[model samples]
Target: MNGSKDIFSTIFSAGTFQMMLRSATPVALAAIGGSMTEHAGIMNIGMEGMILMGAFFGVLGSFLAQSAFAGLALALLVGILAGLFFALLVVRYKSDEFIIGCALNTFAIGLTTYLARNYFPGDASGNPNLPELNLAFLDRIPGLRVINHQSVLVYLTWIIVILAWLFVYKTPYGFWLRASGEKPDTLRTAGISPKKMKWIASVLCGILCALAGAHLSLGQLQGTFTDNMSNSRGFIAFACVIFAAAHPGKAYLAALMFGFFEAIGLRLQGFVSSDLTGMIPYLITIVMMVYVVVRKQRRKMKNE
Candidate 1:
């Protein structure tokens, strides 16, 4: 009992909260993109591949150009190209998104692994990496100051979150995106092609997922690519979409919830086995998904 209390105490500290924000950044970015695709009526499950590719390209661009901005630009370009490929197969050809997504994931792993073997055979730290945003003025503030220093993308994430929320709820395009999924016929009457909307959404998902990968590779302290670096974050971001019903802000919150739990797992490493600790985020994901289903069932029963 005391041990559990001690663990909980350590998990809830400010340091852990800061870590939670850091860990949640990638997930939140992907979740936002997932929400966009979800609202557009396409079941995009290929984020895993997109993220992997982005991470690989981000590092490669940085290494070759010796500039972090070039790395980010490269990641974005790759994302656009990947999004177009996905749209061509799934949107244009009417292919199964799940199958394509799975294929994409497999291709990403094989491709990135092969490239990593060739390009990053050894030390990769000499290349420039994405720098963290250090707010000198915030240093004077207590409490918030400690957590203020994070990846530039981390700070940008909050801005993205706000813009996403605004874009979804306050814009004509947002209505069209949601309508394309929920009321395609109605959207068609308005003369906006649902297919066009789907293509746009898919590309947006690709961009955001790519950004997530870039952040993973260069935005964080690791600042390097590893084999299979995405590590199921794509799926977790999808879970966040479901848990939040495709709401961008809510999805971010869900990602934070997962991040918090994962942070706990990381902290728990000292107290327990690494294997058990690794299960924390996955376990929370399962619970969240189960809860969504249970809630839906309960709502159905109540209506009946």
Candidate 2:
């Protein structure tokens, strides 16, 4: 009984909350971007590729320039180019989004691996770290003090979530974006080009996914870029978009929920097999996806 109590307490500790914040930020950022494209009628499965590209280039830029800001700028530029290229194929040429997405993912993996192996030799341990924010006053607070020290990206993500919610709910462009997915013909009749809206979505998605990747490599991992380091977080962010019904705020919350479970899994490492512990968050994600599918089917049947 004592052991059980201790375990539960440890799982719910302040350290876990910090871990949750760190883990959730990248997914939340990516999911927010994914939600934008989803609302604009684009199924953006290529976020994984965008993220990996950012991870690789972020480190590369930082290594060469010895400046985190330069690294971020390079990552954003790459993201924009990638997004534009993706938009050209999917929106302008009307190619199948799924095939392009798969191609992008494969290409990112191969290209980054090749580049890292050839150009970025040696381990990633010596990379420069992104700066962390320290708010000394938070220590005076009781339970919330854990949030005092975190990556600057964590705070940035919070601002992004608020801005995204406003953008989706309050802006004229947001209305057009949503209408492009649900009623493109109506938008066209109103003199709005749905294709343009899609292009915008793709570009924004790329930039956001790249930012998320930068956060992963630079902020979360402290400036280390490993091949395949993204580790399916892009897919998880896509799932978050679907789970949240493409609402930015809901997507962020869903990401936070996933992050919480992941934090729990990390805490369980000593209590359970390392293999089993690592599976916890992913297993929960699968269960959540299943649940979402079943619920959707049930609603459909009821409506029928």
Each candidate structure's TM-score, on Cα atoms with residue i matched to residue i, is 0.93, 0.94
Full-model lDDT for every candidate? 0.87, 0.87
Stretches of model 2 off by over 4 angstroms after superposition? 277-304
* lDDT for each residue of candidate 2 in 204-298, tens digit (9 for 90 to 100): 89899889988888888888889898888889899889888899999999899878878888887778665666566567767877998999899
Instruction: Indicate the TM-score of model 2.
Output: 0.94
As a TM-score, model 1 comes out at 0.93
User: Which candidate's TM-score is highest?
Assistant: 2
Per-residue lDDT of candidate 1, residues 67-130 (tens digit): 9889999999999899989999998999999999999999999999998889888855556788
